[model samples]
Target chain A: MVERHEVRLSGSGGQGMLLAGIILAEAAILADKNAVQSQSYGPEARGGASRSEVVISNTDIDYPKVTQPEIFMALTQEAYNKYHHDLGPNALLVVDESLSLTDDLPEKSRVVRVPIIESATETLKRPIVANIVALGVLVGASSIVEHEFIEKAVLNRVPRGTEELNRRALDLGFQLAAGAVGGNK
Target chain B: MSPTVKLLQGNEACVEGALAAGVKFFAGYPITPSTEIAELLAERLPLVGGRFMQMEDEIASMAAVIGASLTGTKAMTATSGPGFSLKQENLGFAIFTEIPCVVVNVMRGGPSTGLPTSPAQGDVMQARWGTHGDHPVIAVYPASVPEAYELTIKAFNLSEKYRTPVIMLMDEVVGHMREKVELPDVPQIPIEERPRPTVSKENYLPYDNNQGDVPPLANFGDGYHFHVTGLTHDQTGFPTSAPAKAKVLYERLHRKIENNLDDILMWETKDMEDAEIGVLAYGSTARSAARAVSLAREQGIKAGLMRPITIWPFPEKLITQYASQLKSLVVAEMNLGQYVNEVERAAQGQVPIKRVLQANGELIRPDTILQAIMEVK
Candidate 1:
């Protein structure tokens, strides 16, 4: 039996952080891999720190708690500051540049800053899509989920008629994360 | 073969389990930690043509289930700490009145609204004592989503089989986390339903002795002239305060579960072959303790785990059997020494029983059990 990989997503309450986690876990489940998704949220719906964790495995995961995160994503200053310390040297850390991060980076940890918020508002015209954009970056770095599978899962989760906007958000993230956003080549 | 085992939260599996059990009636209020139970049930129960209602309060929700149960339907209700407390009086009514129903308590951290959304195994004692009196009850503590699904079906079967209430006890962790659960074909599962009365109204005795410990119940106003009362009663079902009659009724009520102890008690044991120390636990905490015992063994320590799948009726017999082999027993629970005390008493001084307890609005993890296991010396 293959081991399961753990992923943790962190952001402010209203940033659709939890939705991002759901989409990724759904992708794994859709891919026929053993997956578990769980969240820890505060009482406040907005402006509060909200977080979600997903476990992708080849075998059954005995416990849902994530003591070690193989991949971590933080979308806000508070989220980054709170979870950045928990990142081990081998962990992948994804950050949203719109939210400033002053925390000293973990030694040898891969830190990728995607303009998730700016792209969500300017390109997608919806700040809520910031999570989707970050999910693209997540899929790019982790290679744990097929990009098409994650897109389809997001479409299934979002409200009908908003699929076009969500799809565009996905395209933006995919392009940016693949180093195709600004003709970086 | 089981479906691709994608992880699902315990609450979600329960919704599917209830559907598989052929449960057709659900009425409940949303309580933190347990809300997912209602949420999932609400979504699925309707698809199966079952009735799911969010009542005004927990009291009415409990009452609604009894009313539904009277209609010859498999009725169920789910709640958390305070809601469980509120449903006690009517639950007593259920026991006295012999209403076979299922109640799921996804326990959260609590004394009273202690922690709204956090997990804790603190309600093991509550499930037993929430309703007053010496009446019989069934409590199934599931450690995983699959067990949640299978035991939920068992809860309904036992409730209908013995004509009493069955409690599906879930704590924060099991209630929320998703795990892969394999569902069996519904027809393959053994389902128990209440025996309907065949006697004519004029000759009917609701509490007839011929029915044995389990009396056949006739729906109210079904032309069966049988008396039902909360007060102490005789076999005629009429309220009687007579000492002899009350004693017989009380003994019969308790005997249904106690006398049939072997059939009612369900427990799981692991690594007990040559163990020096055993960890006794139930509910979600039991799940972690099982793994920790394996870890202890890997480190060259002899540790075993005894889990009470049936939390009530205490499973005092099994605990008594392992009395001699136990070097030091540690009881780890989500609450403060509830089931721990039962182990201590069952140990009977042949061996010492220690307690490793936590009710800090969080789940008891494996490391916590390992720590307690190391302290067992």
Candidate 2:
């Protein structure tokens, strides 16, 4: 029953994907699982491509970075194109509806297309918590980390006075992931 | 405050470790992969009543730490590759002056800002000899975020115990990696303070050798009039070019570490009780090497791992002893043949040395290291 899961969150530098990675790892730790999070970003503060990787295991994690990630999220078209080919077989590829994938993806893979950004702007009224929405969707689909721990980590990490907004955004993500899972069939 | 368990980045662990080690002063310049250490210290040091200053440059930061240490403050500074280069002169000065301070170099791709954000072990030899002349260094490397916390505390402890500069050599991979760490209770962990001079002011010879090799030091403005110079000095603490005095000073500096190898050396070995091939690794690469060793063993290839936690004192005795039982040695690192050279020297043609090197910022994969282990006869 001791299993290892690798997740990578890719997006632009300002999208808070790196924070999402941290939250994911923290959630895994809260659930009594071993976890590590690492990130790679370009020099630019906003427009540059950013990628954060989190690995959760029931035992000690040796290699922290995800190579062929089982759970990969690409919030931007650039991130999708750059990382689409590196998915492991039967992997879960999560992407925003804003990114159109023209290239062929690996066979037997599950692609969850969620309106993460759109939901953040329209429903949450705060586009800044889109990363939390993405986190909720990932956890909702995979169950690599529990929903309660992810929410706890979010509350611990988010800026003061924004807890309610972030929690709402996370719940919205969970709903979106549920809808995406239903629609994918 | 009760001990708390939290997920912390390697840099954050270092800040906490430095805090636990009784570090009251930190002077550093922000650099890639290592800037977070300074940033966290800026926020956390004040809460603990420690002072944190961002110096104008790496050199000034090094100089400031040395100045602060002279006043009996447990001071430290953190920097990356290029900044580590800039700190060499002051580092040498501290080595010559026998100042107790911790210098953190979170290694990045080097040469000249080679790859600021990428991880590299290009500073391994540099940590040993980046400074100009003959000196003894005690540099320790951590392979995990929690070890980053533990070894940082050890770095400060070693610096104070030996009265020398201790380098906490971290790479980008470990520096930036976040892991869940249980902080040790502060009251339970042992903290060391620098040895103080026992003699009265009139008899306080700053460079006095009448005591043991590590002479007790007195704070600069604490009722003691002492001269601290980079130049060679004698028992009176005055500059002297006398042949006998210079020889004694130089030999003692080397011997203090050389004679105490047992106290300074630390390493970790796995499944090596009866193995033909030994994989030698350190820092981030050690993780990969450990995996490779486990995989090789699973495949029925009798392989083992010898990882050095205390890197700079070289752990020659362990390498030599381990080499005696091995048919071949595989040295794996993020840099190209940095520590392997030391292994080659220690192995002394006793076994074939195979190097698994990756200097382009990316970590060496476990499969690649396992491939090397498989290829080894």
Segments in model 2 whose C-alpha atoms lie over 4 Å from true places:
A182-185
Best by TM-score: 2
Which consecutive 10 residues in model 1 chain B have the weakest lDDT in total?
Answer: B179-188
Collision pairs in model 1: A4-A57, B7-B179, B7-B180, B8-B178, B8-B179, B9-B177, B9-B178
Docking class of 1: acceptable
lDDT of 2 by residue, B35-82 (tens): 999998999888988899998999999999999999999999999989
Off-target runs (Cα >4 Å) in candidate 1 are A102-106, A146-152, A161-168, A180-185, B1-7, B40-47, B183-188
Q: Candidate 1's C-alpha lDDT?
A: 0.82
Q: TM-score of predicted model 1?
A: 0.91
- For candidate 2, report its TM-score: 0.97
**What tens digits encode model 1's per-residue C-alpha lDDT throughout A58-112?**
7656556777787888888888777766665667777777666554656556666
Each model's TM-score for chain A is 0.89, 0.94
